[model samples]
Target: MSNKPTCRWWPLAMLGAILAVVVLTWFFDGLKPELRLDMRSLPPGAGHWLGTDTLGRDVWLSILAGSQRSILVSIGAALIGGSIGVGFGSVAAFFGNDRLRFTLRAYLAALLLLVVFVYSIAVLWPTVSSTGHVSVGISILLALIAFVAIFWLLLRRFNLLRSRITFPLDTITQRFIEVISVIPRLYLIVAFAMIIPINMFTLIVLFAVTSWDVMARMVRAEMLKVREMTYIESARIIGLSESKVFFRHALPNAIGPVATQVCFTISGLLIAEATLSFIGVGVSPETVSWGSIIHGYLENLQAWWLAVFPGICIYLTVISLHALGNDLDRMCHSKH
Candidate 1:
């Protein structure tokens, strides 16, 4: 009895309680985040529990309303990203050396080229559409031609080396991870936000894409270690298919850490969403989120509740999630 508050039970109970309140609030028929000009900046009292915003929106109700979508987005992104990351990373670790050996002339190179071209097009669209300059258009056309020329030159060079040597997929994957991990994920999401419309689905897509790398890297490391384990060889010798061995044996052994990683992923995505919403590009204009509530208070510090309550909500959710994740991570390591 060191008096340390290390129990894992609290987070689960706390998260459940919060979610219950949020869900019930969402379904409550009478409560809505309506604007009232006359009721501006009222303190917590008779009717409103958490006070009012500059727009006269009920702070408590707004937080509940925002939680509806915010929680949904975080959960959705976690499930999708975790699934893809763990699945691919496990498989990639096992079969990487075999399946990844290809020539520079492989269609894989062509596919990379296509990806680059599509990204370039996306980047140039706003500029071309907003300012519509002939010189700019001509310059873009020339750049595209240069890209094509460079692509052809690389293809030819790669083709020449196809017979002499094959491409190392392990190297390619590692390089990709390094490159992606180095770039700030928020910047990528912001880039996409500029090009595409922001909505729940869009946010989910963005989070899924940005959030998977950590899980993938973690799973890949675990699977690689598990790959060398004695039982994995036995499974293979018994004629189990790669997929079956992976899911039935390797994945189960390796998933505890990755599973815990999901908690952190959810926490991270929640923060990311809030950051984006604060910047005014997160959800659609009509939709409200925790970040949007805080954003509303930037100009009007007098309405302190606008920032404080939602900040409390976000702090509780994020910290509870992190604490749970930390406990889970410790449990996972202890078992090993």
Candidate 2:
């Protein structure tokens, strides 16, 4: 009755386009690296809509393949990272005693520091060696195991020190978060890429590990507020187990902000992956990605289609995710 027109189909259309791209790439997997030396670097024409790359591979097909990989990395990282953050944060906020909280905080801090140190060593190890006999990738893997062993020993030392001193867990956690927040995230990711393997699975895991802190902080802040609500107190008064009250009541209410954070996080991760690929640190040389496509033809002035087409896809995907996140945030706030 009002003058407003419904555009409910728009979101569906966007989703359908994304799914179509993914599905088509899978269906046409044979075209992934098919070379056409006869048509190398040709501009857009009837035979090749988006033209061919320097290697004579179809630009359009490459974009489609890249999208599938990027989407998989983003979605995989978001789901696993979000779950880990939510679980750890909700439990920390609602269930732990002072000693338990201290131990958790200490462990998280140690793990973060250990990862940074090991990654640094792995990145620089190759340069330090006089002989080129050692493989950087193998060094990183061995360093990972060594670092874990070192962390175990350090954890034991910290546990002993923890018993001798008592500190506010909240204050310690806040300080640690602030310290991490001050460091540039992109540089940190690059550092990890330099040391860690640059395959899709490892990239997904790296993103998840780096990203969980933000999710944890958001969930913890939300849980802190939700825990004081009357419903939570009532659940406790009714003799519900602490885990039951926390998981069933506190977590559900606190999850709204976390969901919004997750949406934005996915977009950021996508961009991060692309940026790393652009700089040659994201995926392996053999793997195709939007960033890799752009990087591939960057030196050729005539291969404009290679850059422009994939660049547009990257822009559209990131914008779509941001719009979705904004809508979710509004819906969540409206409910509250």
Pick by TM-score: which candidate is best? 1
- Candidate 2's displacement at residue 169, Å, is 4.7
Question: For model 1, what is the error of residue 132's alpha carbon versus the real structure, in angstroms, after optimal superposition?
Answer: 22
User: What is each predicted model's overall lDDT from 0 to 1?
Assistant: 0.78, 0.74
TM-score quality measure for candidate 2: 0.75
The stretch of ten residues in a row with the least summed lDDT in candidate 2 is 3-12
- Top model by lDDT, which number? 1
Candidate 1 to native Cα RMSD, angstroms = 6.8
| Candidate 2 regions with alpha-carbon error over 4 angstroms | 1-9, 95-169
Q: Candidate 2's residue-wise lDDT over 300-320, tens digit each? A: 877888789988988878777
The RMSD of every model to the true structure, in order and in angstroms, is: 6.8, 5.8
lDDT of 1 by residue, 1-336 (tens): 553435488789978987886678678856568888798789899899899877787888888788877788898999999988887677678666664445545554567567656654466544554555658866876786677667767778656545434445555666766776787878887876676566787678768866777888898888789888999899999999878888789888877787679989999888888889988885655567899888878868777888888999889999999999898787777677
lDDT of 1: 0.78
